[model samples]
Target: MKSAAKATPAEDSAETSTQLIRDSIRVAIVERRLSPGTKLSENDVGNLFNVSRTLARAALQALSYEGLVSVAKNRGAFVAYPSPDEARQIFAARRLVEPGILREAAARITPDDISQLKQLLLEEGRLMSERGQTARRAEIKASGDFHLRLAEISGNAIMQRFMEELVARSSLVIALYGQSTVSSCGHSEHGDIIAAIEGDDLDRACRLMLHHIAHIEADLDLRERKSLGLKEAFEL
Candidate 1:
């Protein structure tokens, strides 16, 4: 196999900085530290990271494209607040995509992959059991990461990228419409899907995956939009 190409020092540094900024904001959003519709000023981000406005702008632009942030002409950026209709559409798209991914993963997954997934599930369970704002936030992020890991195991780079975007958008949807106490995707349900995959039961895995997605979508209280504010948004 051919070796992967290495980035030059300057390129690596730039990529690392961009990724750091992106991840910081993404994690904040996933943890609900940044609430939906909260304005994200470039200067605020730059100050938070001790980075340049240009880098902050690039990070915000990237997030906007991921559907986690919305940008308006001269209005600056804000965390995306998915409408009920948009929330429905996001879940509908996930239903279309995730089952097939699980099926493929079931067929192709190795023993090590299953082990890793079990470990993640364990960690998720641990986080869920802990009581605190930090534990709750970690659990939320872990729940979304589970689906992203499934996509990664499907061994499709394109699908992996698609799921990454979908999961991020789903975070926004959950922030806006999900009931406060309901787990985004229940840890038990995730375990069931993983069990099916481990057994190499493609049909069962796909079915469980669909059910899992539906269950999450069903938990949403989409009748009314959640109110937003910068104070709630910026708190970590």
Candidate 2:
């Protein structure tokens, strides 16, 4: 699983500090490091990345526009929580939208595209196999980016950007309502979707994409129920 990365000293010198902060936050959001409704203290973030509060504020504002974070007049920036209704809506939109993208990828997919996806999946597998907890987290993050890559290859930059946000937000929703497993991602679905695309079979690609996303949606543990642990209620 792709873990969120702390800002390295080298990256701190990059141009456009605000955008770099924004990208870091985006990775955190995508990798499930920042959960829904978690408060983002501007000063804390600034301190962590060694940036000024002004740069951190700009990054938070950008995330607000992306629908990943919510900003209040007094409460400041916090991770956005999607209500159950919005969760249903976003998943609906993605299922309706992405399968078609897979179809397009099937139609226009170059061998080089398959090669690139293979490389990404191989990295994912390596991280999973080695259990390099930290590297796996980063790989987990990059895995979710596969959809955006597919969209670009499908010849739609606009939808590609939109899919990137949807995929990221999907990670948030799953984190919010899904069971607290160590893995941030399902991890294997990316290769499954790409396999359909590589077969050069559009219908299969559509079906695979739908099935993969449906699997993600079904991962939520919506029931707010739990039993008491031993010694808590019964064993005393």
Candidate 3:
């Protein structure tokens, strides 16, 4: 067989730069460092990442496709500011999709899967117990990751993709509408779901998953939007 073509240095550099910009923005948004409706200037992103405007633009375009960024004529790009109606729709979609995901995961999850999940929970508990901005950010990410991990265990590619999008949008919803008093996902509830899955109790797993999601949605202050600052909005 002929040798496979290799990426040139320029191509590799461009790809790396694009991914760096994309991932930085994505993590910033997901971690709530970048708030909704914050303007993303192409120049600023290029400067921040030390890449060309073209690469920064490409990164923002990718995020736009992921529904985490909005691009408008003359407005450049901004972190998405999802409305109350959109929030309801996102949760509604989750309600339909996640129960099925849990059902499959419960049936197929191996002992190793249970072990891995327990480890993740252990780490989550430690992070939640810690104090400071860094710990809180890690906790939030780990909280969402639990559901994403379940989606992976389900062995459904489409459901996995859907869960990825839903979880990302859920971060945006929490940023916009979530109340400070309510935690994202309770550690105890996660433990209960994991126990049910380990026992192959499909119905119980599904029920617990639905209840978990509903608890998160119920914590949102969806009646009004929170005001955000420009500097705090687009820190990256």
**Against the hidden reference, what TM-scores do the models get?**
0.87, 0.80, 0.86
Candidate 2 per-residue lDDT over residues 72-119, each given as its tens digit: 998788999887777888899999999877776677778887898888
Better of 2 and 3 by TM-score: 3
Off by over 4 Å in 1: 1-14, 224-236
Clashing pairs in 3: none
Q: Report the candidate with higher lDDT, 1 versus 3.
A: 3
Q: What is the C-alpha RMSD of each candidate to the true structure, in Å?
A: 5.7, 6.6, 7.0
**Candidate that would win on TM-score:** 1
In order of lDDT, best first, we have 3, 1, 2
* The candidate that achieves the highest lDDT relative to the unseen native structure: 3
lDDT, candidates in the order shown: 0.84, 0.76, 0.85
Higher-TM-score candidate of 1 and 3: 1
- lDDT string for model 1 (62-172, tens) is 999888899998999999988898999999999999988887767677787789889999999999889988898889889998998878777887798898888888988
The residue pairs that clash in candidate 2, if any, are: 1-136, 1-137, 2-136, 2-137, 2-138, 2-140, 3-137, 3-138
